[model samples]
Target: MAGNSDPLTPRAKIAVTAGKAVAAASRAAGRGSGSVIGGRVALKLDPDLLARLAQNLDVVLVSATNGKTTTTRLIAEALRAAGPVVSNALGANMPAGITSALAGGSEARYGVIEVDEKYLAGVARDTDPKCIALLNLSRDQLDRAAETRMLAENWREGLAGSKAVIVANADDPLVVWAASSSANVIWVAAGQMWKDDAWSCPSCGGVMQRPGDDWFCGECGFRRPTPSWALSGDHVLDPHGSAWPIHLQLPGRANKANAASSAAVAAVFGVPPQVALERMYQVQAVAGRYDVVQFQGRDLRLLLAKNPAGWLETFSLIDPPPTPVILSVNARGADGTDTSWLWDVDYTRLTGHPICVIGDRKLDLAVRLEVANQQFQVCENLDQAVQLCPPGRIEVIANYTAFQDLRRRVGN
Candidate 1:
């Protein structure tokens, strides 16, 4: 409808037009980005709107418990080396949000979507993507979403006969099991830092034997696949054994792992590793993550860690001792309503820093910190939390809703 060369059906055109108007109204009212509500409206009007919108575009779907948004962003950037790309850049990865993104970028040659872990199969079905990148899977949104093994089974069943090339993480036993049914797959040895959720094999329910960089199930013989693409320290080793150094602006080993996966996905679309990585280096942030903002005369570096696995990776990105880390949390609908994940995080690693906790569920985190024997001060809000820290550079690690709240407060 916008600039798409392929004309939408009359009914689909009307639905998309109504969706765009609602989305614009949503933004104008300061409610939020109208992507979700707008897409919902469009779907209600025409049930097949998503598939219609995705027609004629080469699509790539990326799903994982962690790093999906950043990986989606990196893939979009890398694919730009080929042509214009459309993506849900604001971390809206559900059906409605994805529909809105596709509708808006009707003329783009590529559609790189960040599909939520629970919704991956459905999105994959509708988009019929050329490639699907499955990053590591772990427990996230446990109260609302399916368990890790169940999710893996869903993925394995959903992708059984798909023609799409799957770029999967071989380091995660769960992911390996999930993508095993696919006919064509490019295995990437993307490292998994949080191994708690995958200690058992999804294939046989046997205890997984992990030795160094290899994993195998002695009971079932379901071992780690030999990776065609591997992450070797700071370099990504291609199928030809050529090493390409990763020098992205984003920090942490997780982003490097994401880069490895993204490079592999980009290759499926005909973009070479060196060219994809060169273009990916231009992405400084995903949504509001890793954004450094000046607040209260101090530099506040924003980081989003929504679950146990995410927290483990985020801890590695924080500044070393005396930098004053602020931990914020919330039990909103988007945050899974369960504070139990806090207990799973290794708060003891934060023992040497000046820690401040604030959010609707600050007490839950405070109690968890107390149990970990790490001291923390609970504050009423972000302002109070920042006031407790001696200025310079402070790291603020927060869950989903709390991170958005802080972003609004800091005008980031």
Candidate 2:
């Protein structure tokens, strides 16, 4: 038992017990995906299961196109100062996953949940979170999610009725527009590396102008809000111009921005930036983001890049020129059946580097690289690719299912 026992109705209690049984059976069958199916069954048996579990809980809901899982993990770590915080540790962002996390941690009152962009409003309605953090929005799984602008518009309407204090990215035009109508908002300039999805104003359907570091609509008055908290390189800057240096075991500017966004949300609950940033530095790996493991007599660092925006940021973190890198991709159900998004990523950035292409979509990725005028070697498997790399740490970047396959092989 983890918070006080939830005050669930007798029927809801039966549903929870049944779901727990299903979860245990799934784990026993070597399908330990952390309550996904079990939670789904419970919710089907009782559609109001989440609302019941979330009672008397101070919950924080985090949503973004990228960095939702990592940001949720970072915020959970920082929120430890408040009390035990329950979260979807398995990268499950939907209602079932949220239910699983809540049911699994029955004794924890404080909670944080990473929500998929399209499902945020639904989950928020059920959970009634105390705070909502909006990171950057970009085109992801376009086959399934369609356009980023459409998603932002949905958020704007859905969030209008929410009472939660919103912590939003001031640099992202989409994020600014989504949370503009919130009753209370804490804006943070965590930086946006992907701007293709935010080129237009969602409000007026007009082109936006970026002068210096700020963006404003030419037709509408919508613009990038001045952040109460901003990130300056590795430093977290305050509204008064004072700054605190942030250290992270994870690499890249995107992660620094993720940390800054999490820190901003933590401040709303009385956790200071210095304390939050200190705890964040201790996170070397969130899920499979920056995990180094030995496989096939070679050490490898695992990084997940699901879409174009993610690949751009991951490539930026890789060392330049001839560093042995392994890029893997798959078009499984979890990775979206449409592999066309591969063409959207800038694979040319790795032109001069030694890259070994592997996975189910290896042919698709290879074709993309070839069309981009980049040179790469095709490998039969992950172990073979790792063996081809020079001795020592080989950076392995993989999409959804491909990364999971590697993790299982490495016993991670």
How would you encode candidate 1's per-residue C-alpha lDDT over 1-412 as one tens digit per residue? Answer: 1235674799999999999999999999998999999999999999898888887789999999999999999999999999889999997899999999999986699999999988888988998888999998888886898999999999999999998999999999999999999999999999989999989889888999999989999998999999999999999999999999999999999999999999999999899999999998999988889999999888999999999999999999888897899999999999999888888899999978989999999999999999999878999998998999876699999999999999999998
Which stretches of model 2 miss by more than 4 angstroms?
A: 1-5
Superposition error at 121 for model 1 (Å): 1.2
Clashes of 2: 3
The global Cα lDDT (0 to 1) of model 1 is 0.92
Compare the candidates by lDDT and give the number of the best one.
Answer: 1
- Superposed Cα deviation of residue 16, candidate 2 (Å): 1.3
Locate the minimum summed-lDDT window of 10 residues in model 1.
1-10
